[model samples]
Target: MRKYPIGIQDFEKIRKENFLYIDKTQSIYNLIASGNYYFLSRPRRFGKSLLLSTIKEIFSGNRELFKDLWIYNQWNWEQKHPVIHLRLSKLDYQKLGLYEALSIEIGILAKEQGVELESKHLKGRFEELIRKASANGKVVILIDEYDKPITDYLDDLGKVEENRSIFKSFYSVLKDSDPYIRLLLITGVSRFPKVSIFSDLNNLNDITIHRKYATIAGITQQELERDFADEIAEIQQHQPDFLGKLKSWYNGYAWHEEAERVYNPFSLLKYMDGRDFRNYWFHTGTPTWLVNIMKQNREYDLENVHIGENALSSFNVEHIAVIPVLFQTGYLTIKGYNSNNRLYKLGYPNTEVRESLTDALLSAYRNVFPGNDSMSVTDDLSESLKKNDMPQMIKALDVLLSTIPYDHWKAESESIFHIIVHLSFKRLGFDVRSEVHSATGRCDVLVFTDRYIFALELKLNSSANVALDQIFEKGYLRPYQMDARKKIAIGINFSSEKRNVQDYLVKELE
Candidate 1:
């Protein structure tokens, strides 16, 4: 029974403690062979720290840690380089300022390596530490979550700019110390432009979307099946569709549009340990700022977002774009790419993000905390849809709508009702598409379930009869005529005065 290294980011500890380590040394070897300076951007808990830790151990000549791994024989163990490992997420920037926190961290590293620095400021000390640590050989620098200081204070413009300035000064040492550095790999959740580290360090290769190293950070499908074969077999005994369900729930994260999708390793491990399917990764931490941003930009659809390659790569902190932030933070991922136009199509990575993010956005819109009764109401709506209980479904939807604050409903447009209803069904984990277009006409929403398909038309300050007539008149159900599931047509009307569903009609179609 091999132990899962849940929340454990230390490579040496995982190997020595007999944890089930997914061998990523092959990718690491390729990375080292390909470049000396690299930057990786991945969402939180996707094993960026572990990757850096593994590289640190490798450079430190930890041969025993890679005994059975791919790099054990491939690497030249005789060649050892001093490593300067810094995890910005672990730094005390909140208590101490960025400059002081970084100074202490570098000082500790220098102390560990038995080196003394005479420099007074961060830039000089960092340069001094690198040159001294490379006395025997060039130093390998691993900086994990390098942008944490800036990201942590996004709500405060002054603090963000201050941290940016501090980072710009501190990282300026890297370009001058290149001769003393063997390899530098910086991992973070986002790459902000004008950080100077990026502009000054012109040699740094950003492999965030590079096809060759797309699978370097996340656990690919092959790795998952190859690694957790025993766990899968055991789970399949009771849940026969376990593999398929798992893929649907968690295995759709892709960095390159053509690369194989990977699973959120943290969430996968949690599911393996508990044998329960929940929002493991999203629950660990969803940035309140991200949720607030989504609430402010409610008009932007979360699916099929198209962005240019350059625009998708980096954004400035002063002018942040929600789509790029969503993509960088793992809420969205590359789904398709057009080489001719250099455009990337992005969407929700998988069911986990779609459902969890929708719930969070709904909570923000309602001005309530998460885990409110709206979630249970959505659950009730799901149950009603599963049983084809039209009356119960309408009642549940009404309750959900009633919970929304009056300010949200002040707009009193059909689109708002459509968005709320779409979000409600989407949060229920159904296959939902809003403003679906067909040859004849467009439908307000279309919901697909295992046993039923629904064509819905929404109207505000109008009668449900008119909405139902439009649904049939527009031939919204024509496209799903051949679908095997039971087909139903639903029309709903919302009253601005009541701020809830006023009337709804549901009809079965052959």
Candidate 2:
């Protein structure tokens, strides 16, 4: 019966107004006690701003706000630190240059501390503010969305370089003014520290992958089951499987490979508000540009993707790779980490991202938008396979393949076609496994429904019978031979000139 803090980012407002608060004060206490300078990277709307606001209150010696919180008596409230909080998300870096945005904010902050700075440069102005604010005690610096200005210019390399220079000069003051700084916490969406902009601030402890802080921003399963037990009980009175459905939809965001996964706080709260388990998280900040970049870079088909541990967090503004961008931006997450090999296996975190990202990619690369028609395509395929209607299944595939534009077929490789087929079936709620391995060899695509299993082999500029022959010879259907689901072997040939399916052959296993 408590009101959820949907847009309230202020800690004082939430506590005083009696809004629902999932106690994160323990994590805040740990973070503040353990380090002097720290960095945390989380996805947008994942409660980064709120965390910074809470830290601001704690450092400012607001004792009344912490009456019932975990850090109430544990923290030292006698020493009050002047908190200088800056949110880079407020500035429009595209319209106003990066320097001007910093200058304006720094000017206002300096005036608040009863200090005037005549310096026209950003670095000088920032240093003056730090010195003046810490006249009584060390300054607590909290920067939310620290990479917003630079991220706003991701498409323009020239502008990005200019902004990086500005940031490097401005942030270098933190290193020099470390004597007057009590605690510095920087929160952003990405941690591309290899860029020269962050080179001078070398003492920052990046807790992004640290297991102790993984549950700082998002709602852990323990918090969900405990904090919203009443809500769950009420919903299950009508729908018994709501909890399972909710977990499958929005509950698999993992910061560390072995850390406990947490539910997206924004989507979970909105779902509780609407009482519906929909794709609420994906719509918050859709990465349309990410999809466009992936489509442009042909090397990034993103199926069964793996990257080195260093490559996971190592990107610069000048040369940002597709894997790091996707991983940092929350489209992909750490599925598995091999410490011996120093490699990470990345994939979509949950069903919402898997389906929504596929829909976005399908819409970006082709004329066909993902909707009921695409759903019907898979539905038709499922029905055709169940009734043993080979022609109907082939016809359904033809219609689906024809939706792709002709130019895309000419310019892209066979991998694009494979991705389209893979994503199409995946978006339809089928358990699709690309590049699946069997006893002898690997199959191109394997689709599993409730009662049917499809082993599809795709060929470009080759005979359909040849593809079907390879499937039989390699025993691609061997793994599912004894399963209860009916097995179907399908071979489809695509023509580069026609940009559609040229031939199709199918054989059902007895």
- TM-score top scorer: 1
How far off is residue 224 in model 2, in Å?
A: 1.0
Residue pairs that clash (backbone atoms under 3 angstroms), model 1: none
Task: For model 2, state the Cα shift of residue 196 in Å.
Answer: 1.9
TM-score of every model versus the real structure: 0.94, 0.92
Alpha-carbon lDDT of model 1: 0.87
Cα RMSD for candidates in order: 2.2, 2.6
- Model 2 ranges with Cα > 4 A deviation: 299-304, 367-390, 405-413, 437-441, 479-484, 495-499
After superposition, the stretches of candidate 1 with alpha carbons farther than 4 Å from their true spots are: 193-196, 371-373, 386-388, 405-411, 438-441, 450-452, 478-487, 507-510
What lDDT would each prediction earn against the true structure?
A: 0.87, 0.81
> Could you tell me how far off, in angstroms, the CA of residue 175 lies in candidate 1 after the best superposition?
1.4
